[model samples]
Target: MDVEADVIVIGSGPAGLTAALHAHESGARNVLLLEREEELGGILKQCIHNGFGLEQFKKDYTGPEYAERLIEELEKTNVQCFLNTMVVSLSPDRTITAVSPEKGVFHIKSRSVVLAMGCRERPRSSINIPGTRPAGVYTAGVAQRFVNIDGYLPGKEVVILGSGDIGLIMARRLTLEGARVKGVYEIMDYPGGLKRNIVQCLNDFDIPLYLSHTVTEIQGKERVEGVVVSKVDQKMNSISGSEQSIPCDTLLLSVGLIPENELSKEAGVELTPITKGPVTTETMETRVPGIFSCGNVSTVFDLVDYVAETGMIAAGNAARFAAGDWKKGRNPVEIIPGENVRMLFPQRYSFKDDLILFVRSAKPIEKPVNIELSPLGMRLKRLYARPNEMIRFKVSRDKLKAVTGPIEVSITER
Candidate 1:
């Protein structure tokens, strides 16, 4: 099959669905939405929690509900959709080759492409726990799918490694399902998930969160019998005498997430080493002009609202590109992170209008501080900040125009 669309969206997650909707609304009527799953909702289908859509919908909605709303909106439009399709590769000129059972080896030549392949969980192998390859080990997301989607209990006893949002949520989930979650361990003193998740999921459930702790070894051979955990110093080196064994049948890892960008890389988009995602401009356009990126594919965003906002931004710009109204000109100023700042998405900004810079700190700030974009003279007050929580600031064009060079963002204690 040979198909063509004004905009080709790679994933059917919240980001891709919104991108296709906005693209269609922006006069790019021939928008195509593709999903590898049999359904359209992506990971949200398995995420049955109720914290989602608080920002976007101004009310608490479950993950599936949030995705259902977007999917419903997409259905109201003339957008074409292909489910259970696997995109093989994307070319530099915006050509896509994908395969599906119904439509074998289909090709698409699109004017602009929005890549929203989302992210993947970092497994135990990435951290390389000193233990045998056990059958009971699972990623937090896998456990979520097992319980939420398949209605299968992973284990009666669970020990979670890493305080990632998924792990914290799973800790509560397993506990609710009558499983004894021994504890949640983290190498860093601070939690990796949002404050709300830590409070509602872990603290509320009476699950102990072990700070500066890590799993030193996996004790079981066939299935998980127990794990040896130890306290770590600032350098993350294990303390010899601090090791303790916690017996459990399952160990769910929630270490981190890696952006799915092999397709972006194959299409020749330049990615940042820190983000492991494409270095996109303010318009969410990659260094390769016609291809755009948004959502978890651009960076691991904390909120679905922000991801949808990026999708709209990319779609608007893509519509302009498809309409021949876009004139690619000056280079965008680099946005760099300085002291106490860990990462900032949309690493490169070129637009002169108002734009939002989403940032994460290197450490948790106990005292009040000001997030300053220096040389540009832009400052915003943040009462408190955490490495796990992303901070967003809207910068005016006047403030941005004051800088002739790259801008550095840092946190200054007040």
Candidate 2:
């Protein structure tokens, strides 16, 4: 069969749901959402943690509760949601090929599409961890799903690698569930999780955090038995004779996250080297005219509120683009990261509206620094910054009229 939509949002997570809602509210007649999972809310389904929705809802909520609230608001309208539907391919012409058990196979032609497939965890293979084949190793997110949703314990004794937000949260989770957490190890000198998470999940539970340390060898032929932790020098190489064996049955890794953009590649969208997601305009439109991207598909964010915000921006622009009223500004400026910055999203912009540039610092800056637009005199000062959390700079279009050539953002100490 054939289907059509004015706006087609993929992945019914917070981003996708909010995008579809915004598209409909912005005057799109036909909005549809397709989710590969059995239900809506994406990863939030298994994330039973309580540190969500504070920015959007002005109150804290568990993951499922936040999902339910968005779904409830979505259901109040007429946006159609197809669960267990996988979008197999997308074309530059905006034709989506999706498959489902009930529908057999179908094609959707859309005026505009919002890609919000979110991101996946970087696994052990990505980091090249030396280890025997074992059954007890899992990503921190996968272990969270097992414990929170499936009601199964992954292991009794755990040693977590990469003190990311998920890993940090799981440290507390496992400890509260009667599991013995040996310690949390990070290759970076600073904790990889947010400041609040580092305090609440690790320090509150009396869990030791070993920075500049990494697991060099995994010791097990079957289930995970232990890991050889080694301290790394300033250059990130393992120092000789610093190996310490930590006994544990399970290894939960939270090395990093990768944006899922295989379909974006299929659609021939330009991707940024830093964000590893699609290169987009300030409106969140990919180089391809009618397609849009947001949320983790663009860049992994620290909070769900920012994810929803990007979704809203993408959807509104999608509606405008579908209606043949999408505006383009005069000067097209390329945004780049300077010395202390790691990744910057919306790498290209035209100042269509008030723009929010999302960026991550390369390292921790304890002193006050200026977030500057080089040669244009736009600067925002901040007291502290870290790699785990992204820095957002919202600048008005009028403020950018003076900027010529490319706009580069640098964090410099005052």
Candidate 3:
């Protein structure tokens, strides 16, 4: 069967939910939201924690509560939502191919589309840790689902690798669930998660956090028995005499996240090597016009509030595009990451409106730092910055008058 909508949103995560709601509110009738999962919340349904909604709603809410709130608001709108629907392919011309057990196979032709499929955790195979095929090895996200959703304890003794937010959160979660957490080990010299997580999840719980350490070997035949931990030098080469044995039944990995962009590739959207996400303009529209990207699909965002914010940006512009109120063919300016800046999004600027930039630092830097934007001479100061936390700043359209060419963003230390 064939369907049509003014706006089509893929994925029912925070970004997609917000995009669909805002698109309908922005005057796009027939907004269609498709979700692959049986539920509407995406990963949030399994995230039973409470550190959400502070930024967007000014209230601290558990993951399910936040999702329920959004779902409630969406029910009030005219957005048409379909759960258990998997979008198999997306076309540059706004054609979507999806399959569902109920609908069999269907196609959707939309005036505009939003990509908000989010991201996935890096598994043990991605890190290539030398280990036997064991049953106790799982990504932090999988462990979270097992405990929070499936009502099963993963293991009694857990050894967490990587200090990413999920790993850190799981370290505490597993500990609270009667699991003896040996420690959280990180290959990096610094923590991978936010300072708040490090403090609340590790420091407060009296759990040890070992920096510049890695698990060299997982020793187990059937289930996990133990792991060989080793200290690494600045270059991440394990030191010969720094090996230690730690007995643990389970190993959790939270090394990194990769944006889900297979559909983006099918649509021939240009992606950045740095972010592994689609190249977007200031309005969050991808290289393929009428198609937009947001949330973790744009980049592995640290906060859900920003994820929803990007959805609004994408939806507002998508509604305009669907209504033929958008102007095309403008000279796009490049936004470059300079010294001490690791990643920057919205690589292209239209210079038509104000812009918000998301930035990540190359390394952790102490107080008295300034985020400097060249050519336009815009600067924002911060007390401290780290690669784990993203920095957000805005540039007004009025400032574009001073920018003759590309903009270089960098972190300047005092």
Candidate 4:
């Protein structure tokens, strides 16, 4: 079989659906959303916790609730949806090869493509946590899905290996569900999750959080029995004689999320090493002219609101591409990371459109910080941000057009 659309979305997550919605509103009549999952909500279906949609919806909602709102909106649009379909590959010329049980194998020729495949958690094997392969080990997100969506408890006693948002949320959730949360360990001196999450999920639950620590080893054969944790020095080296062990039946890893870009790479899209997402411009257009990216697939976002906002930009640009109104020939400058700032997404910037630069600090900044553009040395924006928070600002096309050198964004304590 063969399919064709003006715009083809590779995922039906919030980013993809929002993009499809925006594309339809932007006058792209034939937009198709492809979802590999049996359902449309992506990982949100597993995340039942509240604290979502505070920005976009102006009200707090659970993950599923927020997704439901968007899904409902999608039903009123011209966007067509294909569930249980997997995009096998993509070509530079905007050709997509996908497969589904009912539709068999098919080729899709789209005028533009949006990549919103989102991200996946880093498994225990990726971190090389020396341990016997055990059955009780699960990523925090997976554990969340099991407990929240499937009504299944992962274990009775759990020790989380990272202080990420998922791990923190699970600590409270597992405890609420009648599990003993041993503790959450972080290799960094500070928590990896948002400070609010640390307070609400861990502190509020009285769950211990060990900072500057890591799981040195795991002791288990069939199921997780316990884990050996150790404090790390300033250099991240284990402090001598600071090892401790905690007995537990499960170990949940919430170390980090990595952007899903295998399909983007297969389609020959350039990627930024800092964010591990496809290199994009202000329009969210990737190196491949007709390919755009957003959401966790473009960069991990602290809030879903930003994902939806960015998705609209990608969708609008993709719609223009589909309408034959996309203009090429703009030279985009690379965004370079500087002091105190770990990395910035949309690694590349274009003067053709206003750029919203999203960045994270390398460490907590308690005082006000100035985000300045280097080389030319102009202050772009000022923010009072903690390391756990994300800072975003827009650079006007006029300002971007004035840059004669690479764009550098740095944070300096006020």
Candidate 5:
């Protein structure tokens, strides 16, 4: 079968669904949302924990609740949805090839495409932790699915590596499910997860947190056994004689999440080395004009609200691109990171509208830090944020209209 639409959004995650709804609302008559799973909700279906949709929905909700709200909203529109469909490849010319149980092999020619395939967690194999290939090691998300949705206990004893939100949440969940959580180990000097999660999930649960440490070796042979964790120096090297062994049947890793950009690469989209996603302009448009990306597929977001908001931007731009209403020749400005600032998104910026800059600090800050725009050295924004917190600052288009060179964001102790 051959399908045609003004906009084709890949993945039925929050990003894809929100993009579809936004595009349809923007008068894109033919918007299609495709999902590979049997259902519309993506990872959210397995995420039974609350703490989502405070910004978008104005109320705290579980992952499924947030996704259901968007799904209900989409039902009021003319947007079409394709479930159990997997997009195999994407072409630079806005062509999509996908297959499904019912449709077999199909083709889609969309004027604009939104790549919102979301992200996948990094596994133990990716980190090269030396040990016998065992059955106990699982990524935090996978473990989340198994425990939350599959109605099965992963393990009675657990040791989570990396203090990412998922791991922290799982530490609490496992404990609630009558599991013994040994501790959470993070390679960084501070927790990788949000401060709220560390407080609520780990600290409140009495789960020990080992910062600046890592699981250097896995001791399990066949079924399971234990792990060897060691403290790491500033350079991430294992400190001599600092090794400690903890016995546990299962090892959960929440090391990191990587944007699933294989299709982006196949479609020949230029990706940023920092985000590992497509290099998007302020409008979220990729180098290939009509192709836009958002959500975890572009960059890992700390909150789902930001993902949905970014999806709206991508979808709005995509709708305009499809309608041939997009104006060209906007001068682009680069966003450069300053001292102690890890990285910034939307590598290229346009002054056509207000732009929100999302950034992460290299380390935790105990004192207030001024986030200022430099080379004019104006203080665009300020926040007292820790390393685990992702800070966002909005620069109105009018504020950037007069600037010509790159926008520099700096952090200084106050």
Candidate 6:
């Protein structure tokens, strides 16, 4: 099969769904959306918890409900959507090779492409936690799918490693499902999830959270029988003589998330080491012209609202590119991460329009700190900052009207 479109979105997640809708709204005549999964909701289908859509829609909603709202809006558009379609390859020239049961092999040539494939959970093998080949080890997402979607429980007793949002939520979920949650252990001194999740999911449930701790080993053969937990120092090395054996039937890992950038790499798109996502400009355009990336595929966002926001930005730019109206920055200004800033997005600014800068702190900082934008002498006061919670600020073009140099973002005590 061979087809063509004005814009082709490569996933059916919240990002891709929004991208397709925005592409149509942006005047893309032929917008095509493809999803590898049988469903259109992506990971949100299995995420049964609430606390979503608060910022985007100004109302709280469950993950599925949030996705349903997006899907409903998408249905109102003329964008064509295909499910159970796996895009195998993407060319830099905006050619996509995909396969499906109905269309065994197909090629889609688009004027522009929007990559919103989102992200995936980091598995146990990635971290190399010493353990036997056990049947009870599962990533937090997989376990969530099993329980929430497939109507099956992983085990009766569970010990989760990593204090990520998913792990924290799963602790409460498993507890409510009659599973005995041992505790959640984190190698970092600070929790890896939002403060609200730590409070609502773990704290409210009376689940213990152990900081600066890790699972040194998994003690099981056929199935998980127990786990060996240990404390770690600042360097993250296991502290000797601090091992404690905890009996459990299952182990869940919520280590981290990595952008699904296999297609981006295949297309020769530049990727940043920190975000593990494509390097994009302020318009969410990749280095390769006519190709845009957004959502968790750019970075693991804390909120789905931000993911949709990026999709709109990328789709609008993609539509502009397709119409030959895309504007390029003149000598784009570089944005550098300064003191206590772990990561920053839109590494380069066009300096022609207002830009939203996303920043992540290197470590936890106390309240009354200032987020300083250098070279402009601009500062925004924040109560506190954490590596888990991202910082977003807008840099107006008025401030860059006379500036012709790079800008640095840093965090300092006020």
* Cα lDDT computed for each candidate against the true fold: 0.90, 0.91, 0.92, 0.89, 0.88, 0.91
Q: Which residue runs of candidate 4 sit more than 4 Å off their true CA positions?
A: 380-383
Model 1 per-residue lDDT tens digits across residues 1-414: 399888999998888988988999999978998899999988889889988878878989888998999889888899999999999999999999999999999899999999989999998889989988888999999999999999999999899999999999999999999999999999998999988999999989899999999999998888999999999999999999999999999999999999999999999999997678999888899999889999999998888889888888888888888877787666688989888988898788786346678988889998899998888776789898888989987887666765668888999788
Residue pairs with colliding backbones in model 2 are none
Instruction: Assess candidate 3 and give its TM-score to the true structure.
Output: 0.98
* Clash counts for all predictions: 0, 0, 0, 0, 0, 1
Which 10-residue span in candidate 4 carries the lowest summed lDDT?
Answer: 376-385
What is candidate 2's lDDT per residue for 1-414, written digit by digit as tens? 299989999998889989999999999889999999898999999888898999999989999999999999999999999999999999999999999998978999999999999999999999999979798999999999999988899999999999999999999999999998989999999999988988999899999999999999999888999999999999999999999998899999999999999999999998887998999878999999889999999999999999999999999999998888876656678988887989888888776877798888898998888888887777899997778889987988888877778888888888
Number of clashing pairs, model 1? 0
In what order do the candidates fall by lDDT, top score first?
A: 3, 2, 6, 1, 4, 5
Q: Candidate 5 on 274-368: residue-level lDDT in tens? A: 78888887789888878999998998989999898889999998999999998886678788888888867777887656887788777777776
Off by over 4 Å in 2: 328-331
Worst 10 residues of 5 by lDDT: 376-385
* Model 5 pairs in collision: none
Model 6, total clashes: 1
lDDT of 3 by residue, 1-414 (tens): 389988999999989988988998899988999999998988999888888989999999988998999899999998999999999999889899999999989999999999999999898889889978888999999999999999999999999999999999999999999999999999999999988899999998999999999999999999999999999999999999999999999999999999999999999999998689999988999999999999999999999999999999999889989998989756788999998999898788987668989999999997789999997787899998899999988888888756668899999896
Q: Which candidate, 1 or 4, has the higher TM-score?
A: 1
Compare candidates 3 and 5 on TM-score and give the better one: 3
lDDT, residue 376, model 2: 76
